[model samples]
Target: MTYESSASAFRHLLEARRSIRSFLPTRVPDSMIASVLQDAQCAPSNCNTQPWHVHVVSGSSRDRLSQALLAAEAAGRMSLDFSFSANDVHGIYGERLREQGAAYYQALGISREALAERRAASLRNLEFFGAPHAAFLFMPVFGDAVRVAGDIGMYGQTFLLSLAAHGLGGVPQTVLGMYADTIREELGVDPSLKLLFGISFGYPDATSAAAAYRIEKVPFEDSVVFHN
Candidate 1:
């Protein structure tokens, strides 16, 4: 393909990609999953450390991990490798978060006043929203937050884009990282490897209401600073 054609195709792919909340129960082939991971391996990292340690789970293992996570949530036992606070998500970021939540809940037909229902809905993360597979991303601390997290973020974006290119869909759930201890115990991962997040992936359920929701991006000028 010509450079212009390739650029246009890439732009289209970026526009088409979105977080898929509901997935069909059908499993993605192992070969395809391997291919996507291989593509994501090309993501650039500081000093070429390639610090990502990914664990992909499926079938019985996936189910067991989900159960453990749900049990931890029920028991109020959250052991996070990294702290998260709702108060930290304020200002324009908070507004964007609220808007996204409103759209998502509305699409799922969840009532804003129904606290129990909302909690139940959130529990679907544990089930991977019916996905047949999931991948938990882990990384070791590299002495600085910027280098470690920036590398993982790029790796994750490449993975997601690779999925999109293959006509698969996935959702990155930070909430899954809250049960870090449970996940490490279930997966038999080394305690030193910190959990970054989990991605649930498969063929998307097109008819699901959650799959229909889309949030608009802020204007480019609002986020970019141009200097001539």
Candidate 2:
């Protein structure tokens, strides 16, 4: 746990992980998912309450969920229970958002004016974007929100890194919140818990157009603040 070694490990993981949008048809083994969940459980929480519950979907259940989401999205039957928003974008935040969108659409060959096509592409977000494994994460209502949120962030990082280590990839999604009602009913989620987010995991399809997008990270100095 020396500083240098930990930094090296962190850098290596940073280089290895990517937001994978296209996945191969291969199924993710339950054991592997379980192990990732175990890694996620190492995330810190208030009094070690953990406060997170996850529902995993695959096989026919995954397919059915995808279909339900797509149908709802198509019919405009979606509603958002919560959302993350930037009320007023400024400087690097706005720039980063635009740049990422440009890069992604360029890779997919999707023109901005192609409204229907863009809508369809966006609906992919609601469908776990076709990844073989879809996991929905929730937080219990009684827990401290800030602590629970931090726990979720830690679990997410661990889960994504675990997938990267296994030659797999994942995309954590917020759009899934749009179909939360349907998702809750379909998955039999408890009323006391709230949907935190959804993550799609599987072997990435390297040749896919969406997979070709090269997401760039700002240089460390540009984003970091150093003390004298």
Candidate 3:
């Protein structure tokens, strides 16, 4: 591809990529998954430590994990390796978070005052939003784990982008990390690896409410201050 074409394609991919909350039951081909994983391997990391360990669950295993997650959630069992709470953020960050949640709930046609409905909607994350596959991302603790987290984020973006390029979609679920102990035990992951987050992926359900909604980014001026 020429410079202009390459730049256009790259920009298109970046702009087209977004979180897909609901997916169809059809599973993606294993070869396609392999291709996306291969492309994602090019993601850059801090000092190239390459600390991400991803386990992709599908078919019966995926359904079984969903059951286990539901049981753990019902019993209030949350085994988090890192602290995370959106409400803890203040100012613009908190406002943005709230805005996203409102948009999502609105799309689902669930009123903010409907606590039970909202809870049920949120619980969909445990079922991987009905996607046929889920990928749990884990990392070995290195130092404070801050740097490792950043590295994994890059890896995740790359993986998501690759999925988009292949006509697939995915959503990253932090809620899944809350059941880290359950996930590790079910997947037989090494004890040393700490859960970060997970990605639910497959063909997006275009007829679903989530497919019609998106959380727009804030203005460029609000995010960047020119130093030059």
lDDT of each: 0.93, 0.82, 0.94
How many pairs of residues collide in model 1?
A: 0
Per-residue C-alpha lDDT of model 3 across residues 108-179, encoded as one tens digit per residue:
999989999999999999999999999999999988999999999999999999999999999998999999
TM-scores, all models, native as reference:
0.98, 0.89, 0.97
lDDT of 1 by residue, 1-228 (tens): 999999999999998789999999999999999999999999999899999999999999999988999999999999999888766999999999899999999998998998998998899999999999999899998676668978988999999999999999999999988999999999999999999898999999999989889999988999999899
Tell how far residue 85 is off in model 3, in angstroms.
1.2
Specify the highest-lDDT model's number.
Answer: 3
Worst 10 residues of 1 by lDDT: 141-150
Model 2 C-alpha lDDT per residue in residues 130-203, reported as the tens digit of each score: 78898888876553576677677777888888888777899988778667888888899876677878889999
TM-score (C-alpha, index-matched) for candidate 3: 0.97
Give Cα distance to truth, residue 214, candidate 1, Å.
Answer: 0.6
Q: What overall lDDT, based on C-alpha atoms, would model 1 receive against the true structure?
A: 0.93
| Deviation from truth (RMSD, Å), model 1 | 0.9
Q: Which stretches of candidate 2 lie over 4 Å from their true place?
A: 1-9, 85-91, 142-144
- The Cα error of candidate 3 at residue 166, in Å, is 0.3
